[model samples]
Target chain A: MYAWFFRELLPGPLWVRIILTVVLLAAVVYGLMEFVFPWLSEYSPLGDVTLEDG
Target chain B: MTPPLPRHADPAQRSVAAATRRQRRRRPLGAKIMGGFGEILITLGVLGLLFVVWELWWTGIEAESDRQDSLDEFYANMPARPAVSDGDDGDNDDDGPNPADFEVCYTLDDGTEIGCADHMRAQTGSEQIMGTVYAPRLGENWAAPIRYGVSATQIDRGGVGHYPNTQWPDEPGNFALAGHRNTNASMLGNQDSLQIGDPIYVVSYDGIYVYEVRERQVVLPNQTEVLNPVPSDSAAEAEFGVLTFTTCHPMFSNRERLIHHAEIVDFVPIGAEAPADLVHHEPITQMFYAGGAG
Candidate 1:
């Protein structure tokens, strides 16, 4: 239960924190993998009008 | 440093050295007692404080790691339901978990093979070697992984060694558990305190079972027969629905296995949905975190 996910995840115990941390980090990575990172191409300007926090 | 701080220097330095020598010779009342005998007590007090910190902070870290690993192993290995075999119409489940994902393992009485999942739900306040032993005889409602057992290492780094091949929780027989002799964690930490008929329990993913301490058995680790579900290790011999809990005697090391023998009385459902009693009955909140309100 106690993990480094304290920043989010379950609100009790060190394990919860760790688990939550890892879970959220994984979620973010998953989002980036599926959404933001896929649309990169040469003609498309690197600078975008909007960028959701990756 | 500077040629051994001048023994006799300028007036101020000379005075300071003289005062230093005088202070060494003029032991204060407290210092006078330091060498007489109190020093040993003071030293012991400091050591005890250090031991307390080690018991608390570092032990908690180790416990947390073990618990996390245990849970991971459980989730990774256990199937949603028990595994099934051929000719069983896919209903047979040999290796999967029942609903709550409780994975069981076996170990010897020497305290080796402390499972990685031991630290899964560890309370982080004090690293007092603690955990509950789920005894079948203690009934499903009475068991919990309370802080039991003695701390073998500096960080209280240890595991609850399964008494090899004892009856499983659901199996008809006694399931024994042993932890450290930690007073705060109690149980194994305080093996001497467990009295006869005291209510105990095992908090498992499947359910909770209430047990009553019936007797104590002081035996060497080699007397493995006591842990046998049949008391003889013969599969043909059915179990006696008993529970055996053990810990080190007189604290410190495993000089002897202080044991509590009990019997199961009730088997409460843990997280089963089909059983209406699971919804209507009092829910066991401590075992699984998101288990309440069902």
Candidate 2:
């Protein structure tokens, strides 16, 4: 699957493709860290420190 | 296998042979679909691991910096003490300042005085830094800024949060606080290590309210009576202050809440000398004594 992305989907030569892959990977990681993970953690119990009035 | 190729076969013929082999090796439609699914599953698995790293490690990095910034702001804004020599310290065995010497720091909406514990009410949808908490038993240099609310905006910043509904330190009721136990800097990660008689110090704008641990209990998350003013006794009038620290129990899980209850044993006003047993963090302790004549 990754081979297909690298060889066919990316519109670049070998050097350019390597750079693009690194940039894309960094973007994905940044998105996950800044947006997805925080949103997902809201549903997780590990960070639920507050006690609800019962 | 039909016949041996010439020593110098045509390059075009060899290329055709390679293409045919590749065609033969092509997967069936079902296999192709299954392989796609497998790839997706692997990606998801990697993402799950990344999430764990983000939760346990990355979040702490952000929170620790936030905690430091908050502490810096609190110390910078700390009120300077007025020079006044109250003769009460000469004869008293306690070297701490007289609570009466400090002006009232909080009052109810109706203007009823709440005394000198530097009580700051948590506003809805916002947070306020109320103080800093120091526990020698937790760590030698362990101090987390205490904030007004226990929500993500507060606790996620690597600080214990005061329950707005609960009483403040030195008040005649349960002064409850909540903190993350295993993630977001794990402010109270060592809560289970607290033994009976361990001192927990809360240094607010007005003074430091010292509490001695009396009990530790693990209770269901829904068992919020532990936060009551007179814990487990809603009907009784609270005679003395109780400091309650609540965190997710069993580390890395929120199945229950670990609660440590401590009774208010001493109060050292901001201008007074910190108690001998107080956690000796120089900059932090100095903030309390900044305005003092001493």
Candidate 3:
């Protein structure tokens, strides 16, 4: 299914398609880092420590 | 059956054809399994690299901008400084009034530089930028805002967070702070680098609290005594204001915390010349004025 989709959706020759795939992967990584992960970390309680200090 | 060959095919072409045939041969089951495992390992490695970039680079970028915005807002809302005329006491210095004469001012032990503890004692708020901290040992350009809490909302903004229950800057107690070592901006990424007698300056709206590193220790995250007025010396009475900086230890791990303790030794009020340690750091001086209430 993925092979058929790529063959139909991707443009140009094999080298062009390879470059396009790499670009798409990079975009995915960037989106995850820029938005997705930050948003997810908001719910994390990692650094949320309150010390009723002595 | 004989396979068809090109009319111009030569001995070299025949060898190439044989090599192509050999390349088409199927791999053994064990080899195929190993290749699949190798591909998975490579995929995992790529994912790990992406995570590292997200943690170090992207987070730093976000936090820096957030810190800048917070500082801008804090500076904009600062109350104007009250005018103090130079008296005819034969000392007409342009560096504002002498702390000895002013009720709001308190001098350090040297009786020269004024303390800001009295000024900062009146200000308090949550998620607010208290002041800028400078540690030359951290780096020449190292300065982080002291926020009100040790949560994602504060620390993730690329600055250290002051423990809410702890004492304020120049206060006669422990003014403890926490930061990340490998995430966000990693404000205290080099907390372990601070050595004995190294200076750590905490600049509030009132003045710069100059602290000298006295000791370093690693402790568990839940060890609350480290935030005490005397720090781990619970039975001992507090004599002077102490500063504690905490961060995740071992880099990229959080199993333990690295803590550094410094004692407030001096205070340089606004309009006065910055301390000697800050002489080489002009940007800090610039930032101090930019955020100054005066």
Question: Model 3, A1-54: lDDT tens per residue?
Answer: 233345547876568988998999889898888787677665543343334332
For B93-185, candidate 1 gives per-residue lDDT tens digits of 553334434333332234222112343234323333233344333233222333332223212233343333455555555465555454212
| lDDT of residue B38 for candidate 1 | 66
**CAPRI band for model 2:** medium
lDDT of 2 at B208: 79
lDDT, model 2, position B231: 93
Worst 10 residues of 2 chain A by lDDT: A4-13
User: What ranking of all candidate models by TM-score puts the best one first?
Assistant: 2, 3, 1
Docking class of 1: incorrect
**DockQ score of each predicted structure, in the order shown:** 0.01, 0.66, 0.22
- Per-residue lDDT, model 1, residue B55, is 40
**Model 2 lDDT tens row, B1-294:** 536556566877765665666577688989888888999999999999999999998899999988888778777776654344555556544444544566654433445343465344432334467788888899887888887788888899988888889987646789999998889999999999999999998877767777899999899898889999999798998877889999998888898899999987776666566666553655555545433344
True contacts kept of each: 0.00, 0.72, 0.15
Q: What is the lDDT of candidate 3?
A: 0.71
Model 3, which residues run further than 4 Å from truth?
A1-12, A39-54, B1-41, B69-99, B102-127, B279-294
By descending lDDT, how would the candidates be arranged?
2, 3, 1
Best lDDT goes to which candidate? 2
Please report, as a residue range, the 10-residue window in candidate 3 chain B with the lowest summed lDDT: B285-294
Q: Per model, how many backbone clashes are there? A: 67, 0, 0
lDDT of each: 0.44, 0.78, 0.71
* RMSD (CA, Å), each prediction: 21.7, 6.5, 6.8
